[model samples]
Target: MLDRRRLLGLAAALTLGACATGPSIHADYDRSVDFSSFHTFSLASDTPQPGAPPLTWQRVSDAINRTLQARGFTRSDTPDFAVGFTLGKRDRIETWNYGPYYAGWGQWGGGPWGPSQTQVRTITEGTLTIDVFDAKTRRPVWSGTATQRLSGPVSQAEIDAAVTSVLAKFPPGSTQ
Candidate 1:
């Protein structure tokens, strides 16, 4: 039997679950370093994943460039920091089942009454990771990651938005 408290708890859980969203963002950096000292940046000469379309690289570079430039950072041959990024995807399977089945008591004692339904779904999750390294130290100074469910082809707007969100905390500590 479902009591009043149990019913209320179930309703709250369902409501919260329904409101859940994907495409989370996270960032971290070395606290000991002074971000303001870094003024210029240049893209690293790392090769894109084999077989990746050239357009994808172009889009990412353009998006990062736009964000950094907007933040008053200049791109130069000899920069204080270097920027690089990686993209990846993975498969995930999710399944859900309908409510419990109720047995109906008739002349035949007890039998299955309510229909039971179940469903399984496959989802592809995409991740974008950006790394910033100090050119002199050749070590990572800052990094950010964004994860989200992927559907169909990725759009330029989506890429731009994700990059912007990840870089929103750029330069860490000090407000700039």
Candidate 2:
């Protein structure tokens, strides 16, 4: 016996909960490569995208540096592995259908099924891909990708969270 307003509010809340669970992270590394030998890293020179904001790139780089340093990897001019990352964003459309809500039996059809509701919204999704390559051989050793729904302009806090979530699996085996 819920009103239309309350039912719609509940549906919106459920949708938000599903969307706000943070970034989806995935990581992979070469099995033959001994990640333990990688003790130092240097940031690769990356050309910013033609129309992208500079601060977003910088924020990601800073977050990578902080995360790696905390994991006991040092920055060096001549390094074991080189780190690089790319950022991308795209618009996504999400649709949710909330089926009938009961409001007590009254009409000839016994409550009229409350009328099915469909909600649609457009969201921006951002993705960050971080790659680690062996400086000597120039072969990739480890890579992580994080994807999340973004809210307008990207913020440093969001960048940090995404970077941290992605790199938490770096080196493959050890707890980070």
Candidate 3:
């Protein structure tokens, strides 16, 4: 027996789950290079999208630095690899149509076949791409990217989560 409260809760949970999807993460590295040989890294540069907030960019940089350091990679003026990143965002509109059966029972006086209901929401999607370049060769050795929906103002925790997800498979082989 599905009571009103339970049914409503289930509906809300499903809706939220559909709206908040996990970040899409992708990473690749050059197999010819010896990843273990690289022990030091330095921030080379960052290209944030036009009109992007500087504070958000800083948070991302800080998160990447922390993640790399935790993985036993040291920061140095003369590094074996130089790290760079780019940030981008775009607006997206999502529409969901619950055809003829939303909130079918209650004081609202709708039967099992209620009128169609549609939901439209505007959201911001953000993408972060990190690149690692061989300092000597000045060529890209590794790259990772993460794309996800941004809810409200960006926070350090959010940035950390995204960075962590993106870099989860760095250095070609070692599991971290």
TM-score for candidate 1, residues paired by index: 0.76
Kindly list the per-residue Cα lDDT of model 2 for residues 79-140, writing each as its tens digit.
99999987666667999877665433565556555787889999866677899999999999
- Tell me how far the alpha carbon of residue 79 in candidate 1 is from the true structure, in angstroms, after superposition: 0.9
Where's the lowest-lDDT run of ten residues in candidate 2? 9-18
Per-residue CA lDDT of model 3 for 99-134, tens digit only, reads 775656563664556678889998766677899999
Estimate candidate 3's alpha-carbon lDDT, on a 0 to 1 scale. 0.74
Per-residue lDDT, model 3, residue 176, is 80
| Model 1 agreement with the true structure over 66-111: per-residue lDDT tens digits | 9999989999999999999877666689998773343343425454
What does the lDDT read for residue 49 in candidate 3?
Answer: 38
lDDT (C-alpha) at residue 95 in model 2: 99
Of the two candidates 1 and 2, the one with more favorable lDDT, higher being better, is 2
In model 1, the worst 10-residue window by lDDT is 11-20
**Segments of candidate 2 deviating more than 4 angstroms:** 1-19, 96-116
Q: After superposition, how far is residue 60 of candidate 1 from its true place, in Å?
A: 0.5
Summing lDDT over every window of 10 consecutive residues in candidate 3, give the lowest-scoring window: 10-19
lDDT of 1 at 130: 88
Q: Order of candidates by lDDT, top first?
A: 3, 2, 1
